[model samples]
Target: MSPAPWDSEPRAQGPTGPCGLQFRPRMDMAKLEEARLFIQSMDYRRTTWQDDDGDTILHIYTAKGQREYAFAAAERLQELGRLDSKEHKGKTALLVAVTANQPEIVQDLLSLGADISMCDIKGQTALHLAATYGFPEVMQVRGRERMPLSTCLTPLHCAVISHGATMKAPTSVQGRHTWLVSLCQLVLSLISQEIKSNKTALHLAVKDGNIQLVHFFLKQPLPDMQAFINMKAHGHTALHMAAGLHTSLHQEDIIRLLLTRGADPSVRNLENDQPAHLLQSGEQGEKVRRGRGTSLVGECS
Candidate 1:
């Protein structure tokens, strides 16, 4: 009779500490072999045990990067109609795969019918976590196809917010922005989706002074570029956010870009304030204010 992996004292926890991905030292192959044999036997009592955290063998195997055992366990769980089972915290095995940064396992689980829309207690789906943590590993997995985009906040919004939070080098940020745009293109219809305050990803980029990302969104060959550029959140367009910035060099640049991209300066927000009305008072601001008028006139002509 094979002893269960957890039969020994001091059972290993796959996720620990603040990160929740600080896996114990490298997986012990000897134990992995034992788990594999046990799962292959399909013994319900040994394979279906849940720890105090409500993590099943599938969840632990996923977090520990034991691919062979994880895959076998996942299949068995699916047979039992519980592949998407959640831990106490609402994290499914797929979510654990993502948190563990195991892209291959993430792909395998998705192939095996893992629910992509499942979210944690915080209402964060796998895509949201991928976007929030800048886990391009997971992002690129679904990016391989026309990945379905769902959730209250689009992945674009999360990616844009994450891009701003990190202080990586310019080239690295640029690379990530490019990757995000490519992902957005796959689901172009949802590219302009909104979140809290009704802010779209474009509004977020402009608010963060991310001129490069702003350019990326505007430059895309989106079917409705005009509407996207002028899309409002709380009646505030990307142009309005740019115009109201505290007079930085990029503020004028962003204002000019938005106007050239057909942002309507006369479009008012809830406050009935147009983009021009929000311009800070300064030489730079005055220049952008004038630029907005010229662009509007050109559009009229």
Candidate 2:
């Protein structure tokens, strides 16, 4: 068999920049066979063929879709107590597999005892990457089982922010509603978990004017109604964000959802400004503020 593109010499730098790093190129059967043979002929345990970016042969093969080769390397590395080894960016094989959307490789890494909770330089875990990239399959990995609430906060935030108004439930059947409810429950649970910025997923959804997401969050059976409704980030509630978003065409609808769900529009932010004050001085804004006040009073009554 002829050599594949990956059989050529390693590039001087990765696509990200001129870091003088080299990574295995795209793979084919011939290159994979050559790599396997090379591994077999050498003291695979003591091989010094790491890329400039500190990626081991396992990392290279795992990322290149040479599944059999990657599995072989991974088994040997795990036996040698290096299954969780990180590349230059603190990316474990699991993180790489997750980022690459290689579910089979991800499973192999997890079964090999790769740490799922390991964070990169930015303190992002595999779950965070999965959620940020919208990979629900990766989120369900066995290694992620029983993850702590705090650890999932960023992933939830990522899911909400990344999804925005894009996620929708089809009106096909009861199963769709059930699935949507379950998804919303998961989203709400994560929204309650505080992140570094103290922002809930609801706050992000509102800020982005994701009407669909905001509605989903509001409809969930929340444990802490006061906390969920009045949760503040940067001294701004979801209501405040909805009202303050100048370009949001659905601001009125979002503001109404928050009010009905127990959001206190009268609550002031760090600037001592109420949600009503954030609205523009116009007929539409006035109408929304009046409607919000009426709804609040009705709820209280």
Candidate 3:
């Protein structure tokens, strides 16, 4: 058989024989669609990075303060795949959710596959995180955020007292304070606990002068500090504590937000004094403003 002109001529053949296999590159739409469907069907958690500290995607997401994304990722991972099987640092997804100060997310994670009995590297569970941190606004964590809401009374107040008790003798409890990341999460816990009318997490953070926590709470969706400024414990919101502790930029802003939010300038306490009155009294008065009795003083005549 006579060879083709291209095959006969080495120059025309390019490198190999005439059959160089010149074919157009197809898009492979069918295979691409299959890959997309596979990704959509799989659980997000399965492909998530393993946290260095054994924290799960849920924990990192919560700590990151991505509320909507965190919950949605958890939901998607749960609905499409195994949720209870998820873990980080020997803790389950439920525990991570609680530690992140996400009571609602905690409940949802639990419904999927969370094991309440599971503990973290520090021997704590979701309940412990909820208790330790309390709610950002009310400082309550009675399981109200859960489904078929719990009948138990808010436990955050008790948790704080208990934690303090440990400090009294110097608990030497020997565990990680992993529930905290940003002061924002801590504040949220205090609020969920209905911890108002006492030294709130915001109040505590201010007294501690943790500027990071201060800024964090300020930017939150429902800031605990906004309603808590300048009032002496007898009358002092967080601003009162900041003024007495050592005022800073956020502290001043806290006062403005409180005022704008309508924190009553005329609201009086046992001293029969308003926030303005307390402010004018003296530095010594502001320093002594925070006390155990202050909680009661603010509550009643």
The 0-to-1 C-alpha lDDT of every candidate, in the order given, reads 0.72, 0.65, 0.44
Strongest candidate by lDDT: 1
- Predicted structure 3, TM vs. truth: 0.32
Q: Write down the worst ten-residue block by lDDT for model 1.
A: 292-301
lDDT of 2 at 3: 37
Q: Give the winner by lDDT: 1 or 3.
A: 1
Q: Candidate 2: misplaced stretches above 4 Å?
A: 1-38, 45-48, 143-153, 164-188, 191-193, 291-301
lDDT of 2: 0.65
Which should have the higher TM-score, number 1 or number 2?
1
Residue by residue across 166-218, what tens digits does model 2's lDDT show?
24422233432343344444444634545566888788888888887788777
Query: What digit string (tens of lDDT, one per residue) describes model 1 on residues 63-89?
Result: 777765777788788888889989998
Clash count for candidate 2 is 0
Off by over 4 Å in 3: 1-49, 79-81, 85-88, 110-113, 136-301
Error of 1 at 254 (Å): 0.9
Model 1 — TM-score against the truth? 0.76
**Which model is ahead, 2 or 3, in terms of TM-score?**
2
